[model samples]
Target: MPTKSGSQRKRTALLLLLALTGCALRVPVRQLRLPDKLPPEELGALRAIYLVLRLADAETASPDKLSRAVALAAEIRRALEGPSSRVVAYQITASDEPADYFIEQSSATGVLWLNLPATEPDPPPQEVDASTATASARPVEASLKAPYHFYAEPGHRLILKDSVSAAHKSTSTAENQRALARLLAANLAKDLAVHPMTLHRVVEEGGEPELKEAYQAAKEQRWPAAVTLWKKVSTALSDDWTPLYNLGVAQEKEGRFDLAQEYYAMALERENSKSRPRKSTLRRLRNILATLNRLAPSSLEPAKGGAAHIPAWLRQKMAVLPMSNETVDIEAPQVVRAKLHQALASRGYRVLPLQEVDEKLKEIGLTDGGQLKAYSTQEIAKALDAELLFYSRLMDFRVIPLGIYYERVVQAHFTLTAAASRTLHGTRSTAQGAADTGDVVLDWEEKVQYQSVSEPKKWAEALAWQILERQVSKILKVQLKEETEILVLKCVNKLPAYFNP
Candidate 1:
């Protein structure tokens, strides 16, 4: 009996040893892994949402948090484009507008509502003396209704959010018009992603809730399915960041590091600083960004010429002026001007030193560029002695419903012009008129029981600015050459590295 017991004990010890060895074989990851390039498939999906963000007067935002929000959006856009997604319009300024096709989004303290109970019509007033010509009115009686509230839960809604409409005007640019055209195509893409119009397509016909299935798939690490579902969510609902954020989290979990980062950047961009991710999440994000920076080519620099790949001929005879964006939204004008300046600088223009530029323009008797609709670029060019003209203006605006989760929207229109007539070149096209940048808009709203009651309009505008920055980055410098050179310099300098592989 003693020998048998000893044998059993030995076998138990051997089993414990095997278990320990198995445990030792598993590795612990101190940091999250991130990929260098945006996954092509994921880019394709993001490009499906043709989001047109409008520009705004950013002056009020200087003391406020708006400036950072705009920058964040721009960074996110750049990040998306790194993976090659054109979902966000190229560039942004304060005076841009949204295209007609893309739906707008906004939120309300978004409460419940009920009409007041009917009351008996007020009794006819007693006739006054002829001289008085006035009458005393009788009051009507009716039971007061209870305070009606829009009983909403604490979740986000993809569709069925509130959206308010605004009017549009005639003045717009070719770039603005192009942005409009692009938006329509993108909106269609969103619809296709949602209902899919086909059996094999990933988007479910029902709506936002349908994505719950995809969310589940992502949690299970099924990327392809999750990608499709997230696309549907993005397209079906215009500006709800909840799903996008979740999708990004799931994508990373599934080992789709590139795609995951894109989503997370966008999600974070959409969220206000107050709503930013926790430190742990940021740490994970930084780890991922560091990894991608290590992997990506470092040559991403601002473009030096027109939209075409060919660099513009450096004409000793110069011609350029500052651009102006005249948007109707109630944002401050100074912010718009500064953003435009930064955007131009990013495009690699040899701009006047900001202080000098301001003084020089003031000396020329042009206090506000937005006021002079026509000859805007010409006036600035002639005054600043900028032989090359850079002009921009704003136009139409509209607000509409977002079906994914019904939301209100705000929009703007704009154009950008770069002419070289000041040097009096024999060029016939005459670099005078502003080119259209297309419709710029921002949107947000809710239709879920689990969402907050914060007004979506502010959020909508916030999104518009965020996406606008990305648009600026894409529009200004589209040069696709290897970014290795600049990247190496940045890395060697011990500065922040570009998020690479």
Candidate 2:
């Protein structure tokens, strides 16, 4: 028999012990699961097959329409012949070669005819029966007309046929035609073969900061950074499947489908049955694996030889310095610089991280592009610890929009220097009367002009109608980022590859 105070103390101790035990036995609820719905694969091969693309036109079609048809056919052919495509080979011809001839001669499995219309047909008038119509009755609206029609004949029978319109309306006819071609090509490719579907990204509830940061980096297309951050989180949370699945997606985007399959399998094994994401993940993994087996069974096997040796030129560290910007767009230099860095890295060059180089530059009070010319190339190379130095100048980046006419211009100058010899390696331009003292590595410029001459009045009417109906027109005049990327790639492709093998 204990006293009253002793009894109270004993009860409190028992309650504390029970609470501790309950906490110890508690399980953590994993709030991170795949999203309920996943997007369809945007690109992949359905089967290992080939097809022939034929361009056909209506008798009443204008020369412009015929040219557009040709462009559209070319774009579709390119898409069908993409890496993930089952189309091992494709023949594009305007000749009257029968589908059977292609099948026999070109090893084509099918023929696709891209028919161009004389003109886009107007929407049919809404039908309404006035006699039987009630007050709430609505007219049946007509569907929009498509400018392009695709007919796919595989074997003896017509297998697939569809009409596709341009992705969006543009002020420029050239742009509109390009957009239409791309949209139709993408649709045709998807219909013809199996393309990889877009996957849903998982978000952890009350997750660590690194997870969120990694997600943001991935969204921005910074693959290397996203991979690093996700890897860190994966190491810390071994049981969590979100990071593993993300890793699979990243690898897949990089064309490392083998590594992607392994990661996806690991994720599925760790996944609990509480969510439906596991089902989709498993299905995707199986589809990819099956496709791989059907196409390249040898790919699944280990390579006979080890990794190839990197050349000495590629092994030497290179640095792309901050570009000198002569344009008003302050962010243009950085955008182009990052693109250049990615291009170099993809080409097997050992390029220093832009952030690290920027830090090194900052240490010496060289931040702006204008300040770069003040420092010697050798001095900058020494500061960056780089063997090779690449410099750039953004001479022109402008977009001028006047009514329905538009002009886009992008010009860049690049120079490469060997730090050890302090010598420039390129042709010296003599176009400006006085030749450049130093050899010019690259001086590239591109300009695009679009004028809507045929339907100026129609465009004006459309503009007025849009203003009255929607308060804004859907015309996009400029795409600076896309134009910049194109410029950078074209410039970098001209860079001499120093690899011997």
Candidate 3:
């Protein structure tokens, strides 16, 4: 008979194989849905509204003034009817089909109010028969008119809360009134829109032909083709979240969980906070997170959804990437990286050596100096066995000419990302320093001070050559180094607050 330990080992191997097979067979399906419950401010995009232009008859105003105001109101009505407006339809006439919401504004003062018309008004009570009336019958309450015009008819609810500013500083009264009329009309059109919760479906419907093709490929489970199209879409709509979300879905379906999770996290970052996440998005996020937590607990540990302070352990194995160079010279990034490395290493931080980092990257099949843009910081950190990643970009570098002195200025942006949770913390630093130009004229006075020699001109010439031959280069380097050091220090000082919590 086999020993107990041998039997246990065999059973464990079998279970592992079964789990791997299950993961391989699983097909993820995500459903995208729009939210139904929306805040009032965002509900304006889904309703039909119209404007009521009430010109306050002022006896002091001339007939021409009234005509001009009417013309301006017509102009505003046209402006409000553009294709971009969410309003179903708008008109200056009250004879149109009853609008769900009405925006009434005074052409004189530019005051505005939104009104909801009563579907049915209570009919006035018929005069009671004197013989049937009891002595204690409720005395008829005399109706008194409201102090200010209610704007809407009886029983209609009017909200007189919105006050708009349409003031113009024109010398001519007519011009000012025209400008106010335009401004008031635009404001009223925007205010009467609905304020209800809403949801949207993430449909891969229309765009470029290539995008549609990509969507079709994804539906057929052809992942690589889908990924290509989605990536193109992402580049085209760099500021939009749709492509990023779609890419995440594709990666998840293909079993590239790590990449999928990163893409989803990025999609969330790109998403607008005002818009609620689709049901499909929320479901997919939860599925990915749960799967990652089960398969690789370490990778899921840093999903803090916020900028949590950097932990002490993460600071042990840190990597600083080459800063992005925005200037003409390509060597600036490397130079700055080397200086920043020295600065960090000197501060007792065990900064990863550039050679060792490159070797690790090669092991992961990334050759050359592939910075964060080429690959994600999380991917690079995992390859280098780094818990913390430092990224810096040189935003500006310029030398301002000042006659005898050149002012060197450097501005840099820095970000620290935690590899485990994908939290980002960033800061910007700037430094300015001056270097003296080695122009011959700059030292003309010093040369004149010692002018008593047989070969005074020759001596002066020799002296100037000795002092100024490489003086400009030397001065620039010193000044630049000083500026770089100051910038680095500022970044370092800010790190504690950003990472510490």
Candidate 4:
């Protein structure tokens, strides 16, 4: 029983009150938080599978758009490279290989198209003459069965819907596409690298208050408090690496590098005794060790009267000739030469660079010949302006694989002599008298075994280099103080003296 104006005003006030009430009752958004570091276990067991990635635009033959498409593909490749990439190995190939998956990035359409093997049964491989080798001749050619076109759903596809068209509209479209490609790569990596999450070990009830307190202090960035608590726990649980690791972290946070290094080393030793230490812990320890090495005084500095006062023949410019390799591997000589060069340089000797020596060898017709020693070192040295020369011969070199482990065996003989001294540096032919034989300086036989999951050639090369490195160290007469790290050995020998010096 109110007037019309009064009734309308009352209804408006009620509507306003209800709107405010609804706004107050609405739920707040939950904050999104990501883990500080992705756990390694999440990647699961590695299964070797090849993923062939090819750019779709590469087939179009459009030079105008090819550059942008190639750039996008490169971005994807960079994102895919990491430790977690153990899941899927990638190679860009046009040749028909038994590929497990094929990913084609179409930058023109801004879509990542995936192709799956067709459900239809594969055709049998056809035999062909070896001279006419092609897909038909390969045994696994059937595995390259035609793939079914996969239409990626919204989640799987990189939808740069307007970006492709915008390329014609603006010059910055290529940059936008590049940004989208990166975003897509990150999303794919995250999805593919799923692994088990590590649970925090904190007791809710009947737990040691001191341990929990230490964790809380560390979390709160209270380095001093955390260090004190962790140290007490370390004493109590002398065998545990957890408290020790925590102590190291706290010390590092507190800027006490020396103490941090000690704790980390202790933690690493303890953890290594049980099993492989955490990757993060191993990385931190290695970094700290490198830093310590940098800070430590270098022992590579030549002694006061070391090589400086050596006889001129030994002190003057030296040359290391490539070792003669009987092995089938063509790279053995190059690897040995590199190791020798590194060793010679550390001794404060003036050794001609490898390329210069190679050029001189080519000019003297010693680049490839019957025997390494057959080449006249004196003539080569005269050509190279060097007074001392090193010659080595590999008697045997083999890398044998035993299951997952690789064993590299190397046997070699070396001789260092005056490049120009006829009495000390001459070599005999089998037809000539034995009195023409050169003076042999160092002869070594190195055999080493190492376990590696990588390719056999790489593992063998690494072991071979180690053998050469140790041999060089022995020749220099320096005590190997740090076995874990290879130190450049000092040169301590009197060889071909420079007549001029």
Candidate 5:
């Protein structure tokens, strides 16, 4: 007896009830219907791998072979870039050293010809038949699989997952096929953290105590003591990069970029450095480099990875969090709700007053970075009725970095969250900018720039925030290598019903 409209209304009500009751169905949507192939942009990201290659022998490759070797290197360089992006190349060869990589063969028409004794030698005949009217020669070919030496960055492993027709997952291609194979094999061996050459250098190393004591000295702001302790530690630690890193920081604090750069180089010799400077380190380093670059700008172009990318849309919708002053706490829900309301609206996004979200956040305090784990997405969404919500975590872990800036490495973790009811997008960036590295006198140059932990770090912190703001805004365009698996699990667990696994 019910009308069709009445039945439709009842069905809609039932679906809404199911969604509200945590019984919403999950769509099997991963492995989304991707185009049969990857776009050029994605592949472009992985090209031009920095390889450390070594040749089989140099004396033999000289002149005729050397000419071929030089020619082969040129060919590989040309092939790394396509009709698109320019290949930024860097070659560091020690004087008179053997070539790092070489081609075993060169293309001749459709076939490959090995750089053999360009003229073949006559092999002696083993047997002769007096009765035979004629004798035939046996066919011989080059050893195609020539052994090449590879010494690449450590802790990275290359798996020879099935080869693709078009150099799938390769940093570059060799003019000759064998050189390409060597690169693949070397990547597969990327897992070895210690090179045989390096292991030979740390003879009977035993000095963790010295390093620990040096760390203590730096923590106490006793720069002189820390420098001396690090010197002893380095001797005991087998010329470890820690001292060099500490020394670099000390030099930076002293505003000695020229000298500090030397220590940075020494630190990098440790290999496969995650120790690579973060944006903060580079910003500080860049400011120094730009100043130093004017004196003698070396060929090494500054790496651009530290720069931030922000989209225009995001630029209009930023939040300005109230700076933490000991008197006011950010732990209250009203504070967070109010800031969100004011900031989002000021940034040009349509939003209601903070009073609207207060009731919802009151049940669970939504203020402060540490307390973010306490909120549920449904609760957050229910509170603001926002299709997407943005959260900023303002932290003041002072006393720590201030202590380490004189001697050791200081680690800082920062995150910005951009969330939808169910779908979430965010970035969790870490900065491990060490202030010093090596055996040195910290106060030897306090009057100079780049030295000591002082009021200047306020400028450093400001730069960090500036970079972070840009990084957060780039989410829509640049696919930053952000791994969500490393995200704060507490918030991950509370994602909205729609994004539930």
Candidate 6:
């Protein structure tokens, strides 16, 4: 028989061993790793549609050039047919068949007309300095015209017309034209396809090994494996929201959107009051939900003639006028205006082409945006045959480079006005109504700044950094185009979805 003291000592030793084992087996905290670049997704309405390619000026185009265009169309078809999107099974026919014919016969949902000119436009006359009479004097570079035009109509409703040009430095016109054709086809395919969304990793320092392994699996694109690991981690750390958020991301990548949304909501519930991860998580959830709603099967149905079928906002014709430039950058206004036009069109707005608007303004002797203050909103809208007028101003556009620092600034203001507002009682002046009357429906402004700083220890490093900065600036137009796009989207989102007459 054991003594009472010895029995008590044995029990204490067993308890101590168990405590040590628990501590050793505990999972440590780990942080998530993010990718360098995030890929963009295409949420446009052109997805999963059969496309028909036809030449508008086929009678005038050369046989060789027409054949090349047909080949390019075939290439575009192959590119657009992918796992994510079977958007375009295209047919290239020289027949003058109408869009209705293809739609009825071949189940085509869209028609793209290639308006290729018979021959390249005559290059501008080269200029030579009269003072330099020597034959060695170089003539000024001549400007080249766009090689092709693409006009697209989905469901017989004209939506997009884009001119294709090549900026290739090659002196061969044929090579440039070929490049232009390929680029046009590529752009069309991109517009119609859904690209993979880039995954965003939420990193926390000193996280569990299972959590790290799950993130690594996601980075490798093994989404199923990642989900499994994330599930284990979430089960173990029920209080932690990070694993739940990651599981949502994995589910989204696997196209299980409903599951992803649920996970996101649950993660939000578990998230602490801290704003950072919560804000980011909320944004992701909203974007996914928006995408889901937009891609719904009901939204894909063609609108009928009935008022119930089409939204009131879609019936309104909007005219986006040339933006007023208050900045020193001469090209800023046009760039921003173009981006705004595309954004509105993508959102299903019936916006007039900028060219048509400009032509109408030209008829009224209004060549500049500053001159718009002279005319009433109704008069300008009537001229453009629009029910609404969108006025924009580029307040600031600049890219400044310091020793080792690069800075970009973009700022813009937008205003939407109802064209049917009654004229003021007192004033015979058309400009007075524009300034005084409360016709402005939506008004907002956005400004953004992007800066990058680097410290170089050696001459080689400094040289490389300078070169990289210059390249980035040149490629993205001073890195301000994206800022301009973001501002434009913000403005567009504020516009009323249902317009009341």
RMSD of each: 27.4, 24.2, 35.7, 27.2, 37.4, 24.9
> What would the per-residue lDDT of candidate 2 be over residues 324-439, giving only the tens digit for each residue?
88898776678788988998898667899999999999999998777876676667777889876677778887655443444456677776654553222222232111112222
For each candidate, the alpha-carbon lDDT, in order, equals 0.35, 0.53, 0.45, 0.43, 0.33, 0.57
* Candidate 1 off by > 4 Å: 1-24, 27-59, 74-347, 352-417, 420-501
Candidate 2 structure, TM-score to reference: 0.34
- Residue 378 accuracy (lDDT) in model 1: 53
lDDT of 5 by residue, 421-491 (tens): 11112322221111111111000000001224535637567555545543463444221112111122111
- Report the C-alpha lDDT of model 3 over 174-220, residue by residue, as the tens digit: 45556655765555444432112222223343467777787777667
- Leading candidate by lDDT: 6
lDDT of 4 by residue, 1-501 (tens): 855698889999999988856433121211111211223322222111123334332222223333333443455445434332321223322223212111111101112222322122233345666696743522221111112111122223322211111111112434444554465445443433222222221211113677778777655656578779878987886656778766655554444557766987897787667655677756766664554433312121211122343334334587777767776756555655566677667645578898898788888777742344565555666777876666666554555544335444544455555443332124422211112233333222322223345566576666666567555754663313231012111111111111111
The candidate with the higher lDDT, 1 or 5, is 1
> What lDDT score goes with residue 7 in model 2?
80
In candidate 4, residue 154 scores what lDDT?
A: 20
Residue ranges of candidate 6 with Cα displaced over 4 Å:
1-309, 422-438, 456-479, 497-501
TM-score of model 5 relative to the true fold? Answer: 0.18
By lDDT: ranked, best first: 6, 2, 3, 4, 1, 5
Using alpha carbons, what is the TM-score of model 6?
A: 0.36
- Evaluated at residue 407, the lDDT of candidate 6 is 71
Between 2 and 3, whose lDDT is larger?
2
Q: Looking at model 3, which ten-residue stretch has the lowest summed lDDT? A: 439-448
User: TM-scores, in order shown?
Assistant: 0.23, 0.34, 0.27, 0.27, 0.18, 0.36
